[model samples]
Target: MSNQIIVTTGIYDAIKETLRRKKVSIHEEKRLATELRNARQVLRRDLPADIVTVERKVTLKDHTLDFEHEYIFVSSTREKLKKNKYSILSDIALAVVGYKVGDIIDWPFKGGNRKIEILKVEAWEE
Candidate 1:
């Protein structure tokens, strides 16, 4: 895979700011940095519908676990509730955001490295 990813300008800035304000593992930090390094930034209006972004319901297939799960990628903790919501700062959300459908990524989590595949993405609302 190429070392390039596509992300909206807003999402990119939010990720950088959130990372600066939070304390995360060095491995995650490095992964995020690498993911954003060659990012093709686009305006919100130009962001592809298939791309994962904040407030979007994303379906991820965990190759290591052999299961699939859906999550609403939220930009703030306030958006999270009992539902299947994932904060942008969380390892899973951070790893999947900015990626498009069919894209598979290996992310370093607390447990170990996991291969996550982007299966679907859809807009969501409160």
Candidate 2:
């Protein structure tokens, strides 16, 4: 998709700072850089509430499995993948980051493609 991914200015800053100071693989650096280059940044107050942003608690349904799952989108420092806390830097989360409620996100995973429909997005209280 050619649509620009929207990122809150706060999130954008955090990601940018992380990229600057953290040591990561070239591939990861390229991915993060691409996100910044292609993003549309906005102030936190202007961020659409339905969209999945940092620290948002999101509920999604797997179209392939007919199963529901809940995850708290966090920074990589805080993610515990199996526990449903997804790092925004992860491939899965990155692919789905700008999605909003009712949006279908399709991404590659493991050995095949996976699809999930966003059911809800609860903005972070802090």
Candidate 3:
């Protein structure tokens, strides 16, 4: 998936607010800032139901590592990685927006690149 993503307007304000409130390091802040500005905001109802968006439960598999993880894309206020919730401000942008079920993500991980395939997209909730 491309770095540029689409964010539903319903969650835009919440994400923006969360981004402003989070006390992230410079590197993380920069990544979030770039992704934030690059996002194209649209109405929640107009957004494709199949696409990954805030509050959606996503099941992804790292093909290279042969590992899978399920995460709920949520605003910072609701983030709890221990509970599988992921914050949009943390640059899990691909897992949160634009991409749809069965889409493969070629995002870079710690040292090398990893391909992640979206297996499922449960409906989003507030």
Candidate 4:
């Protein structure tokens, strides 16, 4: 009696395993890159810069909020008005009256600058 054995190498199995590992590594690298980019953006946005600071103490009934900070005003059209216009502080106060500190806001007018960060809010009268 003679014993005979048959063995074969699986090309498909090897390729599948290699592809699976590569896919996992690619996904991990992408996730890490996204996290790093997000951290950098947050740092850049929060850090203070050299600009004009306009501090305004806004009072509405009994509530008061101190808006003190420097901001950049970008407008496409800078037209001089015949009548005197509202100051930047007054415009910001009107836009952010009901908002609280640490809230992100966006106010878009015909031609206006957007203001962020209420800073501090207090309750007072007159």
Name the candidate that leads on TM-score. 1
Whole-model lDDT values for every prediction:
0.83, 0.74, 0.69, 0.30
lDDT order, best first, reads 1, 2, 3, 4
Q: Kindly provide the TM-score of model 4 when superposed on the true structure, using C-alpha atoms.
A: 0.27
Across 19-112, the per-residue lDDT of candidate 1 in tens digits comes to 6876567788787877888799998888888888888899999999999999988877555657877786677888888889989999898788
Which of the two, 1 or 3, has more TM-score? 1
Candidate 4, which segments miss by more than 4 Å at Cα? 1-90
TM-score for candidate 1, please give it: 0.89
Model 2 clash pairs are: none
- Tens digits of lDDT, candidate 2, 1-126: 335668888777767776787644455566567867998988878889888887898888888778997878988888887778888766556556776788886655544567878888997543
Between which residue pairs do clashes occur in model 3? none
What does candidate 3's lDDT look like per residue over 7-57, in tens digits? 687666655665587755455455556767887787877877767887788
Winner of 2 and 4 under TM-score:
2
The numbered model that scores best in lDDT is 1
> Least accurate stretch of 10 residues (summed lDDT) in model 3?
88-97
Error of 4 at 55 (Å): 16
Q: Locate the minimum summed-lDDT window of 10 residues in model 4.
A: 1-10
lDDT of 4: 0.30
